[model samples]
Every structure is written in C-alpha cells, then in structure tokens.
Target: MVKSGKTKKKYHKPTKPHHHLNPPPAQANKPISVKTLPAHLVLEILYRTPVKSLVRFKSVSKSWFALINHPTFIKMHLDFNTSKNDKNKLICSCGYGTFIDIALLSLSEEPMNVLRINKDFTERPNYPRKINFRDFSKNMVLAGSVNGIVCLSHSEEMSERFVVLWNPSICCWCPIALVETKSWDNMSVGIGFDEVINDYKVICIVPEFRFEDYGWSRIEVYSTNQGSWEDVDKKGKIHFRPNTDLNHCNFIVNGVPYWAGLDLRPGYVDVLGRIDPFTGLFKKIEHPKHVRNEITRVNPVKLRESVAALIQSPGDYPNNVIDLYLLDENTTKWTKMYSIGPLVSGNVCEEMQIPQCFSTGEIILETWTWDTDQDHVTDLDLVHNIYDPKTKLVLHINHMQALHPCWYESYSHVESLVCIKGMVQIGKEHRDKKTKPKMKNWTEFLSKEFDSVLHL
Candidate 1:
C-alpha cells in the first residue's frame, strides 16, 4: 500500500543528441578581456571607433583611459582617419543676431535628393555664447577649422574682439584674449596647424591706417604653443585689398592660411596670399588663368595632396559653370581639373564655395541659387551639390529654406579627437579659470539637435 501510494515516476523528455554531443565553447560564457587582445588589434579597434566613443572609453579602466588620452594614440587615430578617406562633413552656421543656428551636413556617396540638416550647433556643448545680431549687427563667422577645432568670431565694432576656439568633438572651447588690432575694418582671421612644430596658430590681418591709396595691411599671429599674440616679423609692407570682405577672404589649405587678395591693378588676375604659420612667411600665388574682365570668386581649397582653387565665373547670380584648377606643389602650375555644370536644369547658381575635394574625385560645393521660375531679384536658395568628376554625376541636395540664409557660413571638417585647449596652452591662469564645462552625452546631444531637423 505504501509503494502504491508513491508518486508515479516522472516521465523524462529525451534531449536532442546534438545538444549533449557539443557543449558551448569555453570562451562563450567567459568573455575575453580586452587586455588579452593584441595591442595592435586593440589600437585598430580604437582607431575605427568614433571620437565620442573613445572619450567615453577613457573611463573604462586606467590603462584604457591613459591610452585614449595619450598623445601618441591621439596622433595615430587622427592619421588613420585622415588616410582612410573618411567622409568630410559640412559645418554650417546660419541665422543672425541672437538666434544664430549651427548645423552639420553629412556627405554620402549615395545620391540624396534632399539635403538633411545634420546637427544643430545650438544644442552642442561649448558653443560660443549667443550674441544678438541686432545688438551686434553682424553675423557670426567661422574663421577657420583645423583638426576639428573651429575658430569663431562675431562681428563686434570694437577694435578688440573675443575669439573662440572650439572643438565640437570633445565639446571643449577656450576664448582667446581680446585680439587687439589696428583696425577692425577689413580685418580677417584664419586658423591653421603647423606640422613642423606640432602647433596650431591663428593669423589675423588688420588694415593699417594710411594715407596712400595702395592698400596696406598688418599681420598678427597667435600661437597656441606660446599662448600669446605676436606681431609677425614682416608685418610692414603687407598689402590687402582695401574694403575686402574679410568674412569670405580667409580659408585653410594644407596647414596654411590663404587669404583672397583683390587685384589692385587693372589686370584681372586673382591672387591668393598664403602665410606659413610656422615660418611666418607670406607669398602670393596667381590664379590659374587671368579671368578676363569678369567678376570672379576664387576659393582656395585643399584637394588631396595640393591646394586647388574653385573659380566661379562672372560672379553674379544665374551662373552656368564652375572651373576647378589644382596647383602643382613643385612647379606652382595651376592645372584645370574639371569644369562642373550647367548645373541642375532649373537652378541658377548665384554663388559657389567649394569646401573640400577628395582624391576619390568627389567635390563638395555650397551654392546659392534661385529657381528658373524665380527672378534674379528674388532671394537665392541655398543648395549643396556633390559632383563626381569621374562620372559627371551631380546630386542636388535641397535643404529647408527656413534653416539656411542667403549668407550662411560653411566649413569642411574632418573628425578628430584633438583637445581644443591642448592644441595650445592658453595662459596657466586663464586655462585654470576658463576650464570648459563637461559635455552632455554626444548621442543624446546629437539626437536633440537633429531630431527636429532630419525627417528622413
């Protein structure tokens, strides 16, 4: 009776023979430590990750933190990215007065019918303080960007104005002390890196008050390594076209700042005045061809290994074509690279600014244009064109009219982990007092800036 009362034996379900035949790999449950990875493999992994990821990984462990912050690692990562033909992004600053808007546009090989607003600058950490365009009466201009650091200055009538050096990647920024110059009129500033000294520099050109008709300009340079401004040794005898629109005059190419020089003479030769920040030498390069009697705009851009000029003809609205010419580094000969457009059928290009051209033959250009239905008197629309020289394929990217102005500032930037403050020591006292605030999580910050802008 006791045996009968015992519970019936539970039926056992048969397991698959394969399940018992093979157990999980030993390393499956126990994740391999990153420390166990070969050093070269680890470095390769870090190099491929985005800068924001590297910044956060600095907290993973002391070893990782040190490695991420190490100067050697930083340089290697930058080099790797630069060599990999990474897509260059366009950073655009629009709006005027207190409501200035900043955005980033990601360029892709895939044809895009519409230009998507990438990231808004307002939502970014360490962005320069907003100034009322009405109060200042001037739009903020991006002086130049080098190694992911952008120098921003607002139009202030004062002889001395504040300039901000910002690293959007790390969200770090430092304001250079008030830059004092002879005249704010016709003044231009540019930022560039010096490979020899491994330093970053800011070059300022201020018109010298003079009676003579010949336009004269003075040069002052601020070295990040020195953390101070010094008059260029050959400051005198510097000449720039009087009344030059400094806003569009300066750009960086191959670690040098090139300022557009007005043809003071009757001859219509466009000249680019280049300054080597390291040696502080100034030289002028003549345009590819003497543009005959036409109002031409010359944009000096870095094209692969050498500097190239993107020249627009008849510099007025409703233009039909653009000429690209690359400079020979050794001979200084300007060779015609490609003739872009008869653009999109209905669009009339008013102005074109070429930011960057890759060795892969893709050229990024910002154009201000108007639809054929719209007259020249109408406001020009902002358009971005990605032209493939090889295939002559043009991808027209139309953006929101509200976000882009007739005169927005744009720069081509490569991603880097460079520290803004580390580029050059600001003063010890200034550095201690003006430490950059911590940035919000990049993923979260980007989402907020782009959520409303990007619908696709």
Candidate 2:
C-alpha cells in the first residue's frame, strides 16, 4: 500500500566492528628485572662470565646490555675476581707472543694451586705468535690496564713504521697511520683515558729534527670516537738532539698520558711533561724534590690487578736496590713507596726491576747476577724475587737467564714468575735458610697456600 516508493527500508551497511586501531596494549612492555637482581648477585653472575660475554651482553636488551656494559659493572667483576682469594697470573711476551699463566694465592688457610688457562678458557684469550703490525714497527708498548683491557701501542719500524691499538683481553686491535711522519724521526706513542671526553686517546710525539727548530716537538692525538689523529698546539722551549733517548719522555697516569723532558737549557734538567687530552695541551710537572737526580725512568705499572701507575726508578739495570713510586689517582702525585735494598753482595748481584706492584704491599722482581763467572750471555742467575715492602722482606721466587716481557697477568692479581717451558719457578729449589725465621720465606709459604684457582 505504501507508495512503493518509500525505500523498502533502506538498510545501512552493517555497522563495522568498532575495533580500535591502537596496537594491542603494547603487550604490557614491562622492563626486564635486571634492576631487581641484587647487586651482589649480579656481580656474582658476572664474575663467572668472561670478557667476551660482557662485551656482547650490552646488546642483549637495553636494560641488560646497559647494566652489563657499564664501566662500573666491569669494575665490579674485577673486584669480585680479585677478592675470591689471591689469583696470581703471570703474563709474558716474546717471539712466540704473549702467554698468561695463572696461579692461585689465597690469603687465608687455602693451599696454593697453579690453575691452567686453556686456549679455550672463557676468561683467557690466546694471541697470535706474530701480531701483525698495522702501520708501524715491530715493537709495541704495553701502556696500561683497566678493567682487564690492556692498552698497547706499536712503534714505528726503523724502516717504515705505524701505530696501533690493542686490547689483549678481548683480542681487539686497530692499527692507524702516523699522521706526521714527514719529520722522519723515531716517534713516541702514549695511551691513556681522557675523562673529559670519556674516551681513550693515543698520543704520538715526533721530535722535530731540523737543527733550526731544536727543542720543538710535534704532537698528535688519536681519538677513538673520531677515528683520527689531531695535532695539538703547545708552546715550550725544548732542546732537540738528533738522536736523543726518547723512551723516558712519555708516561700514562690515571688514563692521562705524560711526557718527561729536561730543562732544554744548556744542561737540561730532567723535567716531567704531562699531556691533558681534554685541552690537548702539554705542561711540565715538577717531580717530588726527592726524585730530582738519579737517572730516573718513569713508566706505568699495574699497581694492582685493576689500577694503573707511573713507576719511577733511579735505575733498574744492574742495580740491586730499586725504589717504587705509585701514582695517586686523586692527586696525580707520584708517591715513593718502597725500595729493594743493597742485597748482601753474595745474596744478590744483578737485578732487573719488576714493573708490577700490588696493593697487598708486595712486589715482584727479577735478577740475573751470577757468581759462576759464566759468559754474560750464558751465565744464568735469573731469579724472580717477591719483595714485600711492608715487611722489608725479599724471597727468591723463580730463576731464569733472561726473562722476556718481564711483565704479565695473573688471575685477578698481576703475576711475575711461572713454570712456563722457557721460564722456571725456582723458588722451591733454593730454600737457603735451613732455619725458618719469624717472617720466614712467606713468599715460598704463599705457594703452599693457594696452588690454583678451581671452582667448587
């Protein structure tokens, strides 16, 4: 009846389902529970992990990788490894490359055990026999160690040289060209951390050789982030010797590098030069009045398993007596701490200063003096001695003819001597004292304490 007209109930399209276009509530993207893990628990877990895991963990998840990659985390891992008893490791470099030998030295009533680090160990890394030189010479300088990362630099070859950076822990290396080789001088390289930039820097100092510009030195700094070397402008009256001994001129402290020089005057007085990576500037640092004379050599040392130091010595060759100066992080001051004495002539004849020092107030030393009168080359009085500066005691540790590298790593602690094929731990053989003194051979006694690091 209707006017067929009226739309037979015009039907609107079925109402579309009103599903919101928003993502499914973000799946409650809750953060990881790393924050919930107790600091001690997290540190404990990290302690059992190796450096490679730590480096890779940074990308696992923002929270995880960040927590694990933090410098603080690395530091915590180091502290935990160190505190778990005295883990001593001896690292050496020779024609064969760098080798690390681990020994356990527990402070308490634990027995000494020599733990073996297999080529496959998680914490230990094996290096190639002949490390390829990136751009420079065959020689490399072991600059400093921080959080298990050993910093090193390559010297320019006498023929053609380049500089490189390496971290032994992770087996990471980067070689870079020396920007200002035009001077054709044997350049010097130094590495340290620049706090201002929170980056590590490598400094190369090329002494200007032209007689006209006698004391002038051209300096360049390599920044890791920038991946380039930049020349630093500095004004100082420096005297140049065509072939001067440049080894002692540069040193690293608390991540900053320093250069040592003399007055540059007629008879230049020894001057210590420091480079501030932040300002890219160089300034002379006055030595403690006590260290003025004495053909001094300033170099870095592993003050402990974790700390870096500037070790000053009047001399390390042939001198039976050696003194140590530790770098103070807060003050940037070199504190003269201990001396290995005038050994009764027969007791010790020749000595090589061991560069490693530990907070335990113990130091490792090496010597090669012999009474047999054997040819200097053949004569073997090589002895590794543990010197306790706190107690004024020195114990013969190991012996060899000519110890190579002279420095190496130990577990969480720095090690000096181990019974490697070419090396020998002769401490047990030379028990000279039939009578046990009060202090006794605590050094030898330490061996009986913690033999090796083993997991229970």
lDDT accuracy of residue 253 in candidate 2: 41
lDDT of 1 by residue, 106-137 (tens): 54433221112222224432223432222222
- Models 1 onward score TM values of 0.71, 0.56
**lDDT, candidate 2, 1-456, per-residue tens:** 656655567778988787766645565475446445554555567667755576676566645544553444445566666454354333333222433232233232232323222222232122232324221223444444333333444433422244555444434455555544365366555665566656667666667757887566766677776877664554443343212544322334455555556546456555556666776676654445444234444444455432333333454433434556655545757776666565536433463545445446466565555554443343554466677756788875433212433333222222211111111122222225466445433233222112121110
| Candidate 1 Cα deviation (angstroms), residue 80 | 0.8
Clash count list over all predictions: 5, 29
TM-score, candidate 2, is: 0.56
Worst 10 residues of 1 by lDDT: 111-120
Q: Candidate 1: lDDT of 334?
A: 92
| Best candidate, lDDT | 1
* Best model number under TM-score: 1
* Candidate 2 Cα errors over 4 Å, as ranges: 1-40, 52-92, 95-139, 146-149, 155-161, 234-251, 259-261, 286-320, 323-339, 372-378, 399-456
Residue 289 lDDT in candidate 1 = 79
RMSD of 1: 10.7
lDDT of 1: 0.62
